[model samples]
Target chain A: MLVFHTALMRPPVIDNLQYAKFSPRIFEEMRAGGVDAVHVTVAYHESFREMVLNLEQWNRWFEDHPDLIFRGTCAEDVLRAQQSGRTAIFFGFQNPSPIEDDIGLVEICHQLGVRFMQLTYNNQSLLATGCYEAEDTGLTRMGREVVAEMNRVGMVVDMSHSAERSTLEAIEHSTRPIAITHANPAWWHEALRNKSDTVLRALTEAGGMLGFSIYPHHLRGGSACTLDAFCAMIGEAAQRYGARHLGLGSDLCQDQPDSVVEWMRVGRWTKRIDYGEGSAAAPGFPPMPTWFAGNRDFGVIRQGLLAQGLSEAEVDGLMGGNWHRFYAESFGPA
Target chain B: MLVFHTALMRPPVIDNLQYAKFSPRIFEEMRAGGVDAVHVTVAYHESFREMVLNLEQWNRWFEDHPDLIFRGTCAEDVLRAQQSGRTAIFFGFQNPSPIEDDIGLVEICHQLGVRFMQLTYNNQSLLATGCYEAEDTGLTRMGREVVAEMNRVGMVVDMSHSAERSTLEAIEHSTRPIAITHANPAWWHEALRNKSDTVLRALTEAGGMLGFSIYPHHLRGGSACTLDAFCAMIGEAAQRYGARHLGLGSDLCQDQPDSVVEWMRVGRWTKRIDYGEGSAAAPGFPPMPTWFAGNRDFGVIRQGLLAQGLSEAEVDGLMGGNWHRFYAESFGPA
Candidate 1:
C-alpha cells in the first residue's frame, strides 16, 4: 500500500558506507563508481557540539563541491543525485552522541538532514550495549523511547556495532524496522562485529536491513578476501534473509590515516590504546581486498554476484536496488 | 576544599530565569540591577540543530553587546562578569531537547557551556516526566545514563518543570546535587507547577538548590501576590531546606511578546494552542507584581527578604550567594 516518488522509480545504486577521510577526490571516486547515494558517517566519538562543528565542516564541503556531491536527506534526494550525475551524501552518526540525551533531538537531527544513526559504536551506550561489551543489556529504558522517537522522526536505528541482545531488542521495540548498516554475517566471517544467523533472520523477518561490510576485518580472508567468495556469501545470506534485506555497507575508512582509527576505537573514553578489530601490534586499518580497493571496484562486486548463481533481479537488489527501496520506505516519519 | 578566584570572592547576585525577549535593553536593565550572572534558558523545545541556531543567536548577542553581556561557561565566568560590571549569561535548557537522545551530548553541551539542563519541561521527556503530563514516568533507561553523564560533565540536572516522581528520582539518581531552578513550594501556592514539601526535603537533603519563581501562575494570588507574602514563603522554604539550598530563579519573561509564550507552551508538539498556566480567555504574559517587575526589582526582593526576618547572610544567600557557591561547585566535573 506504499507509493514511491517518480524520482525514486529510477534504478538507484546506493552504498551505506561508514566514514573515510572525506575529500573532493573521494567524491570524484563515488561519482566514478556510479554510487548514487552513500550513508556517510558524520560522527563517531564527537559530542553534540563537536558533531555540529563536523556538520559545519561538511556544509563547507557541500558548498565548495556542489558539482561533485549534494546533501541527501531522503530517498528522492538519492535519485536527484543520480539525475544530476553527482554523489548523494546522506549524513549519519556511527554513535548516537550527536543526539546526546534528549529524545526531541531525534526529529531535530532529521530536520538537519541526518538520515541514519547507530545506537552504539562498540561500547555500552545509553540506549544499547555494543558488540564489544561483555553483557548485552538489550534496550535500556531510554533506548526504547529513543527507538520510538527515531521511528517517528524517520532516523534509521542502525545496530552495526551493537550487541546481539541489544540489536534484537531494538528490532522488536522499534515501530519501524531497524538496520545493521555495516556488518557481515558471523556465519561467513566469524568476527565479533559480524551478525549471527539468528540476528539476520530476526532482522529480515521484521522488514529490517543488513548492509554487508567489505572491511577486511569482517571479511573471511582479511585483505586477501576473494570477490567470488564474498559474492557467494552474499548469495547464501540472500537465500536465507532474502535479497530485499541485504545491500552493500562497505565500512570503508579509505584514505584515512591510522591515527584517526584511535579516535574511532578509544575516543576519549580511555587514556590507553584499544586496537578494536585490529590487534595492538598493528592497530591500523588493514589493506582493503585488491578486487574491491576503492569506489571504482564496485563493478567487480556486480560481476561476481552475477557469476555466483543469483538471478539478475536478485543481483540488482544485492548491488543497490534493495537499499534504494529500503531508503524510500525507511527515511521518513512513520 | 575548592579555591575560588578572587573575583568570585566578591558578593554575587544571580538569577536562573527561563527566557526573555533578549536585547540590549534587558542587558542594560541587568547592569542597572547590578546582577552578576544569570542562567538563561537557551532551549525549551529546540532540537540539537535548532538549539545550535539559538546558541548562534546568543553568540551574536554576546558579540554585539560586549559591554552589557558576556557568555558564561565556567563558574569563573560569573566572577569575570562581576569584575567587568557585566551580566554573565550562563546558558541553560528548560528541556533536554538540546542534547537529544545521545548521552555523549551531555558532555558536549557542557563543552559548549550549558551549565544547567532540566530533565523535562512540563511534558514526558525521554529522561523524565514533565509537570504537566497526565502520567509521570520516572527516569527512562536513557535518563539515568544522561543524569550520570550530566553529572560527569558538570551540567546541573534541573527538575524545575518535571513531575514530582521524576524530579525526586533525578534528585536521587544524580551523583551531583540537582536543582529546581524555578518553582514555588506547592504548600504555599498549590499550583500544579509548584513542588511539594516532600520534594523540597529530599532536594535539600541531597544538597540540591531550589530557586524561587516569580512567575504569576506559580504565585499565591497570581499577579497580585505581595512581596511580603513571597518573602514569607522564601523564609519558610529557607527554614526547611536551609538557606544554602535556596536562591532566586524569578522565571522572568521580561519584554517578551505573547506569541513567544505560545512557543514555550506548545513548541511544535501541538498544532492547537495550549494556554498552559494561563486560561484560553487570557493566554498572555500576566502582569508581574509591582514590587518585582524587572531586573531592577531584584533589589526589592533583597530588601523584602531582609525585612522578612532573614539574617544578612541568609538574605545574601537567597539573593545570589547560594547560587554562586552552587556555580562554583556544580559547574565542574564531579
Candidate 2:
C-alpha cells in the first residue's frame, strides 16, 4: 500500500513511546497512520527472563508479519522503514526491572536490540526513585555506573516514570543527552509524572528530546482534551525548548484491560492497593482524548500543530524528524 | 583483511559445527583459516533462561568484537561474512535442555537466532533417546510435536548424540533434511557417537549432511591421527555417502580446562560421574589431533582433502558451500 503523506513529501512519523495491546489491527493502524517507527515498551516490572519471553512474542510478530513491521536497531532503520513503507519497531523497557540488579545486562539488553530503558517505573527502585515515591533520593551509586555503561553501549537512559530529583540528576550526570520520551511539561499539567519547567529547560539545554504525552491522565482536560489544546501545549513547549527537541510520544495504552493497569500500578511492590495516577473511583486506563484514540490520528495531529502557527519544517520536526535524529544519536556505542 | 582462498576463488570455508572456547584470538584464527561461518554450540544442558544468559554472553562478544565476528541468522550471512572478512557465528544446541518442555520455545530459540537444536545430548530426553540410553524407543510423543514445530520454524533437528532408533525416526519423520553436525562414520572410528552405515545411508538418501568430527574421541587414532589418514577416511566416506554430505565439525574445545569437560559430561544430570566417551583414567577433554588444534587449521584440512583426491569442487562443498546451501534451506519458516 502506498501511504500518502498530508505534507506532500513524507516525514518519518516516530512515536517515541507507546505500550498498546498490540495486534494485527494495531499494526495496520500504524501503516494507515504512516507511522515510520515506534519505541515500544517490552518490559515494565518483569524479570530478565520474563522480558525475554516478551521478546519472543515480539519476534513471533516480526516473523508472522514481515510486510508491515520489522525490528528497528538503529536510526537509519527509520528512514529505511520510511522508504519501504513499513514501521520499524524498536524495543524498550518501561522500568529497570528487565535488567534486574546486574549491570552487565545493560549491554545484554542492548545487544538483544533494546534501545531505550527507564531508570525507574513507579516506586523506589534499586537505581532511582520513581514518581510515585514521596522522596526522590536521585541516582544510586550503581545508577552512575549503569548510566556510563548504557552510554558506552548506546542504550538511552529514559526518565519518563521517574521522580523529579532522579530525572534532574540523570540529566546532569549523563555524558550524553537523555530523554523523557513520554511526559508533559508540569507547567501544562501538574501530574506526578509530568516534568518540571526546570527539567524541561535542563533537558533541552543538554540537547535532549521531550515527547509530548497523550495519555489522558497526563492531559490537562483528561479525555476531554481537544487536539488544538494538545497541539497548543506542544507549540508552547517548542517556544521554550527548540522545535527540534519536541515530538509525539503518545503513551497510548489502547485496548488494555484494567488488570494490566493494576499490574503497572502495583507490580508486587505492595499488598495494599496503591492506585497510581488513577483513583479508587476510576482505577483503569483512562479514555484517550477524542482527537487521538489510535495511531491513525497522527496526520490530524500534524494538521493541528500546523494550525497552531508552527511552520511546516518545525511541525515536521515535531512529528518525527527530531526523534529520528535523537534515535540515530542514542542507539549505538558512544 | 582481504581473505584469499586456496580454491582460487573463496567458497566460504565453513565449519558446519564447532564448540571452541572462543575469544578474539580464536575469531582471528577463523579469519586466518578463511572460515566464513560456524554452527556454534551455545547450549549442552541449560534451561531456557540459562540459554538466554548464554545468548547474553554471545551478544557481548558480538558487541565487543565486531571486526572479527558477527551473529549469523541466515545462509546469506555466510556470504556476507565471507565478503566482509569476518566469521558468521550461527547458534545451536547440542541438547534440547534449552527448550525444556515448552514446545513454543522451539520457535522462540529460532527467533532468538538459534538455527539448530539436538533432541538429546547423551541421555533419554522428553523428546528422544540419547545414544547411551539402554532402550532406544525413538521419538517421544512430544518429540513428534517438537519435530513438526521445528520444521515449521526452520530449526534443524541435530541427532549427533541420539540413539540409532531415534536418529532413524527423526530422519524419516522430518520433512527437511536433518544433520548429525559433529559425528564421524562408525566404519572409521567405531565410537558410540559415530554413525553406522545403515544410519548414514538413511541420512544421505534423505539429503542430510554429516559433519566429520575431529574431537580426539571421535577420530580413529585419537589425538595422534594423521591428517592423511583422517582425510582418507573422509575420502572413503565420500564414495559411500557422497562428498556433498560430508563437511567438518572440528569439535575444538581449545583453551578449555578439564572442569569445562566435566561440566559438559555431567551437567547436573547425575550425582555420580558419567564418563561418557572417556574413562576414569582420561576423564577430560582429549587432546586435539595436531593437524586440527584450532580454527587456523581449516586451510590445511582443505589442502589435505584436495591431496586425498577430492576434486576442488567437491572439497569446496565439503568445506562450506554445501553446508551454506543446507543453511539456506534449513533456517527460515517452512
lDDT of 1 at A188: 92
DockQ, per model, reads 0.02, 0.33
Q: Rate the local accuracy (lDDT) of all candidates.
A: 0.86, 0.89
The digit string of per-residue lDDT tens for model 2 on B166-190 reads 9999999999999999999998989
Once superposed on the true structure, which residue ranges of model 1 sit more than 4 Å away at CA? A1-10, B1-334
Candidate 1: count the clashes. 8
iRMS of candidate 2, Å: 3.1
Q: Compute each candidate's TM-score over C-alphas.
A: 0.54, 0.90
Interface root mean square deviation per prediction: 8.9, 3.1
Q: Looking at model 2, give its docking quality level.
A: acceptable
The residue pairs in collision within model 2 are none
Task: For candidate 1, write residues A92-145 as lDDT tens digits.
Answer: 999998778876566656756888899999999989999999998899999999
* CA lDDT, candidate 1, residue B112: 63
